[model samples]
Target chain A: MPYIDIQNDLPGIRGLMAFSPHTAEPMGLLANALLHHSDGLLAAERELIAAHVSYLNDCFYCQHSHAEIACYYLDGDRQLVDQVRTGDDQAAISPKLKALLRVAAKVQQGGKAVQPADIELSRKEGATDKEIHDTVLIAAAFCMFNRYVDGLGATTPADLGSYPPRAKQVAENGYGPHIFSTSQPAGPSVKPL
Target chain B: MAHIDLPDLPGIRGLMAFSPETAGPLNELAEILLRDNANSLTRGERELIATYVSALNDCFFCSNVHGAMAGHYLQCDMEGIDRIKGDFASADIPAKLKSLLRIAGSVQKGGKYVTISQITDARTLGATDREIHDTVLIAAAFCMFNRYVDGLGTQAPPDRQYYINRASQRAAEGYLDFELYKYK
Candidate 1:
């Protein structure tokens, strides 16, 4: 039950579905980047950051899905997941990771919340400038993504395992191969909906 | 410069930091959960979703960092990152992913953005209820994270490698070992 009429007929918040920047093409691109891109942070760590940020925002969808995905990398450690979901950074991870998560948490709360002391501590733990920057970006990005989905009232499946296969495929194929509902191939020339 | 004032450096937004009992604990718990939880979605895919959401929000700081992180799990080309960030539908991703991204997008805007068709479509592509729920949560949470960072005008490091090494370390350590700062 969405509050507004979405041009796309979404399930969550109808208002955002019609107005949010989400579209088949861009969505695919974003997916590819998230799964296929090469960079400093590993996929698992990045997912951890996302889940953490989403939890802070209370974005149910983002937190749940990313958490599921994160499990794939953690050797299916549900206990570890519980620890993260419970806000215990001191569970069983490494000191550097703990430090990084700390900085990430600060970012999720507010950039200004990230203090010089935080940076000094992370650096002491061997966190580099790029790591700090990436963590902040990851936190900031999840915030927007959470708002977009919740705002539009997008439909979500009832089952949780529904995502792994798709995640696996996306992880394997990237974003360029998946298209939805368009009779024509995706391109700039394609008419805007 | 940020539109709001610093939370404590003598400004109106000075009261913005997360309280230990409030968003602080919640966010920390979330980080651990995603890192350790098991269901369906892969850690790489989840990170990718988060990164994409950040990019859509125009949160430059988040987009780059997460982008790099997602890259680490990608056993192949970084081109996937470009494709997803550019256009998901036209990109080379698999069907399940397309649906997941669609769900993630819905969350990014708001939960209401998703539609029955989207869920059905995801299921048709083999997405489960948990997958759908998690995707939505990720999107919703990122919204808060993005706003928190942009709202405060956090500074990002200029070096790319800085993110890489840190990412490598976090990837190996996992979130359970995350530490908290005890300011004196």
Candidate 2:
């Protein structure tokens, strides 16, 4: 149960957002820009970075949900998603992605944990400066998202079946629409200051 | 002198030079988070949250700059601020702020590490839901800010006065006014 009386059924940050729509707006906008935007980095790769960070943080809802999204972008390669989540070094992905994942891992540990050599390695692997920068931001932002979800004691769906459909919806429509959609019954609307 | 050739930049600005696109929104987010009055947390308390997380992350520049801002807002001397950073529990501060700092520490570690008891303790000590919410966001945001500064190996000034001066300017002028580098 959440520390506060949020909707019992709404999973992860969705319930928390419903509880505090004020903060949710900006948070959702940030997510849309970071994960869904058509930037230099592909959406799948960005979702992979998010999933990897959530995996490092052991945020079950984030890791699983983003992995589903990543799989969708990667042609339904859930095995690759699992591999990246567990250990990207052993995962069969491009060296550039592997290097970026390394950078993301360092961000997960702490900012200072990332060293100059790491950036150099990523660059050597054909990672652009933009890709490297986005990787760091995605990793850093997920730290906030992961914490916000778990920190508020938001519910994590026990059923794996629940995530893929939601992931499809998010992949198609982005985060803004679903953030305020009341189709799913939420808890009493409270002001999230 | 950062990993990237950011001429004369120091602290977080140096790292942000690598990607100006993200920096715009991030700076906007900081302005709203630190200076906005939407929440009841005093700017001093919010700065203390940032400083405490920086200290935990061992980011010298963030700790010093934000610590100075925190001291400025709280009317605290350097010694008092240092004491709080070193050990907020025993520091001479209000019980409520101390409890909130404890929660911030947990956030710096990992979100899951924040236990229910801590939340309950903070509530018992009169920290409102907004205060708790803000504390978590501040701690979480600083983790990103600290990483962005140190991840790219930005240089920190050896002279503590650098941060003290910067703090006064930031407190007065605010974060939005900084002319950040555009690397597009």
Candidate 3:
């Protein structure tokens, strides 16, 4: 179904890292900070940004994966995740997050899409400078991530349950341990030029 | 400086879901997914993928914000976020990430830009299906996000501190508690 070959099974980035332990380190570090680090954006909001962006990009893997994690923090409400995916602004989210999502949506369309009023509105909603900045960052980072998966034609799990535990682990442990999965390689790793 | 106008803040979508109390439910759900959802990708790497794509897309807000996030995850020795934005190929990152970045690049160009061999190459460098999947999603999503921001012409704060301080809080409290502004 994908454009390329990917392993049938194996955790998220873990299998890829296993293919090349050395090369996976930096990614692991990035994951460590973005997901687990204390100073970075909250894991839930990060996932929301990821999910929202994935929805916009039509990246199935990201959409499904983050959707499940979102449910976990949403008191196990899957419908809410679905609502966000649909871009239903009236999806019962907070004004702040709604504003942030608007910014994220704008960012997904392109950075230039975000207007000055958006910033003022976010500020009015108590979205601090860092939150606004991170919202944009979250949108931007997910774009690269979306392309990486879709670009390579990597394996995407049919089962939504497959991603949450992994997400939780990455949230807790970081990327170092799973870079080079001890298991056999299941997917291709496209090297960046 | 942006190419587009930021869509109505609290426009149709938010207005439809009016009331901060009512909106709390959605924010709570989003918060869990954004910050709490765990994955194999390290915080820095995920943020790096985000930052790299932002740079590629030329979304200044995302590039700077996520760059700082990636920097937060890195150790004292590495350039971290700078390397990702400056030159992913030579950023002292792992071979797989380099490979992943390639995939990310292709996504930036277009989904069709990614090739089978690229996947193999990334696998050769130790990438998993989930990692690859996440990469694609991140790249693809960022494209939309970049467009959203750029498309709407959202404002970028004048100072880096604005981004840094806010980012730290979002990093700490998640999205639910951070809601500060409200509209009639």
Best by DockQ: 2
Q: Rank the candidates by TM-score, best first.
A: 2, 3, 1
**DockQ for candidate 2:** 0.56
Question: For residues A62-148, could you state the per-residue lDDT of candidate 2 as single tens digits?
Answer: 998899888878887888898998765788888898988999999888887888888899999998776787788789888788877
True contacts kept of each: 0.39, 0.48, 0.49
Docking class of 2: medium
| Model 3, backbone clash pairs (residues 3+ apart or across chains), number | 149
In the order shown, the candidates' DockQ scores are: 0.16, 0.56, 0.21
Could you arrange the candidates by lDDT from highest to lowest?
A: 2, 3, 1
Writing each residue's lDDT as its tens digit, candidate 3 over A1-193 gives: 5543344344434444444343345444444444443343566666676788888878877776666566656666667777886678778877887888888887776666677888778778887655665576567656655665556554676655555655554444454655245443232322211
TM-score of chain A of each: 0.73, 0.91, 0.78
| lDDT value for model 2 | 0.80
* Model 1 residue A61 CA deviation in Å: 17
Candidate 2 residue lDDT tens string, B60-137: 988998898998889886677889999888887889999889988998888888899999999999998778877887
Each model's lDDT comes to 0.57, 0.80, 0.60
**Is 1 or 2 the stronger prediction by TM-score?**
2
lDDT of 2 at B9: 67
Give per-model CA RMSD.
18.7, 5.0, 13.4
Candidate 3 stretches with Cα past 4 Å from truth are A1-13, A37-41, A171-176, A179-193, B1-106, B112-184
Q: In terms of lDDT, which candidate is strongest?
A: 2
